[model samples]
Target: MENTKQQKTNVSSKTRTLVSAALFAGIICITIAYFLHIPIGGNGGFVHVGDAFIYLAAVLLPTPYAACSATIGAGMADILTGSANWALATIIIKPILVLFFTNKSKKIINTRNVCAAIIAGIVGTVLYMIAEGIMYGSFVSAFVLSLVGLVQPIGSFIVFVVIGLVFDKLKIKEMIK
Candidate 1:
């Protein structure tokens, strides 16, 4: 019983440490993304650093941690740019993808994982498109919306794949465990 209690306490402490690290790392990435905004597709946004953090969180952290990291990370940029509405959708969607898709004990960043990540990104983008289109009619056409959703995921996949390769070569995969 004492050993079990000690083990539980260690797990709890480790979880807390990872969660705090993710939160802080998320904030840092979001700040950099804000300063270096790169727009893609009609409504899709892009960033170099944001993906690194998201992919890392998805690979290393649990669902809740990944979700919180994505929400706070990307949402921070959206909030700062006076786009509170966009921030809200990002907070909901990005983390859901990271969490749901990365549930198994699998590395979340790799060539194969990038393919899975691409599919997940499309799902996330489509979700945002549907929600935003319904609320604001921001999409000029359904076709355009479809294209935007597809293109962004493809772009993200390509970018993250490259980043994943770099990280893999550098043996960052070990860090995720």
Candidate 2:
């Protein structure tokens, strides 16, 4: 009975910590995306490193929590930064990016995660291209604009790798677990 009670307490505590971390990650995502964005394309698109936090959240938190962090943070940034048109797409796409990663890994940076990041980048780019094509009613224009869009995923991958290395060295995933 005592052990069971202790287990419950631990679970409750971990849940609180994870929720708090997700909230914090969301805020970081918004701050980086809104404040540090570089405007690109005529459709109010920009490239930002905010996705790094989303990637980190994916490798650290559970899937649902990571998805929430990515969707809320990226979507809120779009809304707050006068790019509300992209908010819906952001909400839809960001959570999908989280699906490519896993928190079950013992280390933040690993071969599987490295592959996941690459695949996620490609998937994110394609999804955004489709979303933009649909929104603007011109797949050709979207394709042209996607040339610029490609920078984001590439940049995000670099940022994620750098940050992931540091987090791995610090054993942040292990500590969180």
Clashes of each: 0, 0
Give residue 82's lDDT in candidate 1 (0 to 100): 55
lDDT of candidate 1 over 1-177, digit per residue (tens): 999999998898787757665774555456436744555444444433454456556665666767677777777777665556677777777677675345353444545465667667767767776766765677555346556446555555666667666776776646545
Using lDDT as the measure, the top candidate is 2
Weakest ten-residue segment in model 2 by summed lDDT: 27-36
Alpha carbon lDDT of each predicted model: 0.62, 0.83
User: What are the per-residue Cα lDDT tens digits for candidate 2 across 79-168?
Assistant: 878889998999999889999887898987888888888898888888888998999899998888788877887888888999899988
- Candidate 1 vs. truth: CA RMSD? 4.0
State the displacement of the C-alpha of residue 57, model 1, in Å, after optimal TM-score superposition.
1.3
TM-scores of the models, in the order given = 0.70, 0.90
Q: How many backbone overlaps does candidate 1 show?
A: 0
Candidate 1 runs further than 4 Å off: 1-32, 39-52, 103-112, 138-146, 149-151
Task: Give model 2's TM-score versus the native structure.
Answer: 0.90
Alpha-carbon RMSD, each predicted model: 4.0, 1.9
Could you tell me which residue pairs clash in candidate 1? none
